[model samples]
Target: LLDGVRGWLMAGAEPLQRLAAMPTQLWRDVSESTRSRSDLENEIALLDQENLLLKGQMQTFWSLQEENRRLRAALNAAQPLEQDLLLAEAIPVKGDARRQFVLVNRGSRDGVFVGQAALVAEGLLGQVLHVGPRTAEILLLSDDTHAVPVRIARTGQRAIAQGTGNGERMEILYLPSNADVKEGDVLVTSGLGGIFPPGYPVATVSAIAEAAGGDFARVSARPLAPVDDVREVLLLWMRDTVSADLPKTDHAP
Candidate 1:
């Protein structure tokens, strides 16, 4: 019995000795894994911060580029030296489903008034609808309610070009069914109404069709003017008393 007892005691001590040696190796592996995880987390955070910084920088660069272009164009157009021509920067776009509108920096104090004509980089925009002290509202050529006197540039046939409340669509009322006008014909201001100048382009004929039993051809117009992409406009100075009288409002106060 004594011999059997001693053998069992030796067996128990051997296992305890092995267990004491194992903890150091296990702790070393755990520390290494923890360090690896910490490094990966830090790298991910750095990348996220870098991406945000780059996006902000890109936005600033593009904004500066657009502003530079606008100022350069304004400088060139301002060189004509008319005593009364006022150049205004377009500030905001007021989008309506049936009409297009823009707000310019000039207003009544700057001689901008309702019914005063406004032109963009390409061509005619529309007449001034509402004027304020520091800002003015411009009605675009695409409004359903606004109409302009126009002529077929190729044939000199006078007609009224009216807006259709959509992109590049308008109407001409008095063109005869057999008029020399056809698709792809260009239309310009006729200067008959005395609102627009004689040489500025207005639109192009996109389609021509006869109404049911009507004497006139229903002509569709696509405006040559840049109505949607305007960032600045030129306000013409009127020396003629007639143009001064054309403004809808006389009292600025």
Candidate 2:
């Protein structure tokens, strides 16, 4: 062991002695080693940071997938109700010149047809204008051509609620000047037209104006149901009962 140690010292020290490296060279090597180690540590930290970011993205992906699955399940559960009605989705909005209508994801294939009543949970939105194999257009209650015979929910004072394209409101026309309707009066479908059902909340009197020149009181009402927020609506397919099937269209006797 002693001989081996002496031989190693002689051989090892000879190269250093011949090279004549200064103290500064040794310090430089040590500093370079420290710097290389620091660079390696920095690279490792960067890789760790990249890995954390990737993990966070993966977590977000999974969360969105879970949320989508939950929504799909809820939509499926809304099917198969025992009521004489069909559920349909309003999936398209056509805002074009010469054609202003909405298309629904229901049609003859889904047992929907023309003249069927389309109603939201709040109230009526429209009726089926044209139905195809898997889709239909709904003439929204706000359309200028749409008309609904409505009555005062309080006084039963009958009047025709006409769509004026004036958003969120229905124009109750042909009311008598001395009518008892006031602001905030509730208006509902009388089912007198044989189109809409009775007791469905349609709109509320937002403004009551009595123009002196106009013989009729202009009673404008805001729709209780949201026209733009219509997502899912129910179609009334049940045939009316004996009393409702009478020849007299007016429900108010």
Candidate 3:
């Protein structure tokens, strides 16, 4: 009887011991799971940071690529020109709508002078209005006070293109009501004023309004050169005879 009782006691004590050990085992498992989750969260945060860094780098890469393309295009445009060309970086001058102009790195020290013509890859941009020691100011063709003599490429019709203070539009003045002008006609510099070179694209005819009895037609044109967006310019040194009659003034006309 005593032996059977001892066996029962042993079985009961074994179960109690296993129950006491279960809490410790469960705590250890929970600690391991928590550690694994913490590690996973830390890894995720690190990846996010890396992703942002790469995105920023990509933006810089795209910007550099665009700048390189622009420089190459400008160089190609300068190669075929017969005139002496100087490449200069243009900096925009803000404020004062009446004085719409840009300053270039080239100046009097670099042989830049008043009345020098400035061009972009597309076409004529403007004329140099003032020259300093290290910088020169160029008067944009879109300034209200600016004007250029132009001829219609299709019909050889001559007229004066005056700026409307808007970068995208200009007015063709003194065309007869019966003039052979139409939309999409290209207007090029006639070189009559002696400030700009001949045959360079100036503007394109966009619209025309003619009055029944008026002698002149109201013509609107869009400038060929991106006057507001140009970042680089080519300064041309024309023959002395061409620029000899150019007027020197604080403001260009």
Candidate 4:
């Protein structure tokens, strides 16, 4: 009878042992599943990073293409001018926003002279302000102190468009209140001051507000050549050509 009771007790102890092991076995399974999920998450993160890098590369490629296209157009436009041209890359100067000045790679050695007009395919950029041995400073048309002689393309009415130190806008100074000007009228260089060539696009009228009890109209326009994004420019050598043609005279003591 005692032996039978001992066998029964042993059978009961076997089930209790299995019950204790159940929690440990379940924990191991959960750990394995968690590790698999973590691996999948890491792979997804790496793929996303790769996709972003590809998108950035594509954007850069398109930007380069557009820059090349503009450069080609600028070269073509310069061919029609009788004067020689020097191609130059625009360099951003520190404090350019306030001074509205840019640096170019051409200088006196390249026949670039002060006051020579800088242009792009779309319109005139500015005049050379300062010259260095290997570089030059350009006074952008958006400089507050700079002014360009411009005319209404439609009616040939002349006016002086002055820079407001703003890259995207210019103001016509002393325009008569009754002037035959309207919004969207194209303004071009009048070739009056002999600075910029005639018929080069400058700006277009954007707004005109009449001065209260005054004869002048407060006119504002947008510049055709905003140099902020342009990569290259044409330096007109017309002034150099003219200087070359002038007869040099010896000075007497």
Give the winner by TM-score: 4
Pairing residues by index, what is the TM-score of model 2?
A: 0.60
Model 1, residue 140: displacement in angstroms?
A: 0.8
Winner of 2 and 4 under lDDT: 4
User: Which candidate wins on lDDT?
Assistant: 3
Query: Which ranges of candidate 3 are over 4 A from the true structure?
Result: 1-82, 241-253
Instruction: List clashing residue pairs in candidate 3.
Output: none
Ranking of all candidate structures by their TM-score, best first: 4, 3, 1, 2
Better of 1 and 2 by TM-score: 1
As for model 1, its CA RMSD to the true structure in angstroms is: 10.8
lDDT tens string, model 1, 70-183? 545533432233223456788966477766788888886666768887876555678899999879998888898889998898999988999877757888868887789889
Compose the digit string of candidate 2's lDDT tens values, residues 1-253: 9999999999999988857866778889999999999999999999999999999999999976864563443334233322245566678565744434578887765666687777766666778899897788888888778888888889999888888786577788888888899899988778787777777677899998756877789888998767867777666654443233212322111
Q: Judge candidate 3 at residue 230 and give its lDDT.
A: 75
- Candidate 3 lDDT by residue in tens digits, 1-253: 9999999999989989989999998999999999999999999999999999999999999987875675455445432444556678877667576677889887766778898888887777889999997899999899999999988988988999998999999999988889999899999888897777777788899998865698888999999889878788877776453244323433211
Task: Estimate the TM-score of every prediction.
Answer: 0.61, 0.60, 0.64, 0.65
lDDT of all predictions, in order shown?
Answer: 0.75, 0.73, 0.81, 0.80
**Which TM-score value belongs to model 3?**
0.64
Instruction: Write out the backbone clash pairs for model 4.
Output: none
- Candidate 2 yields a Cα-based lDDT of 0.73
Ranking under lDDT, best-scoring first?
3, 4, 1, 2
1 versus 4: better lDDT goes to = 4
Better of 2 and 3 by lDDT: 3
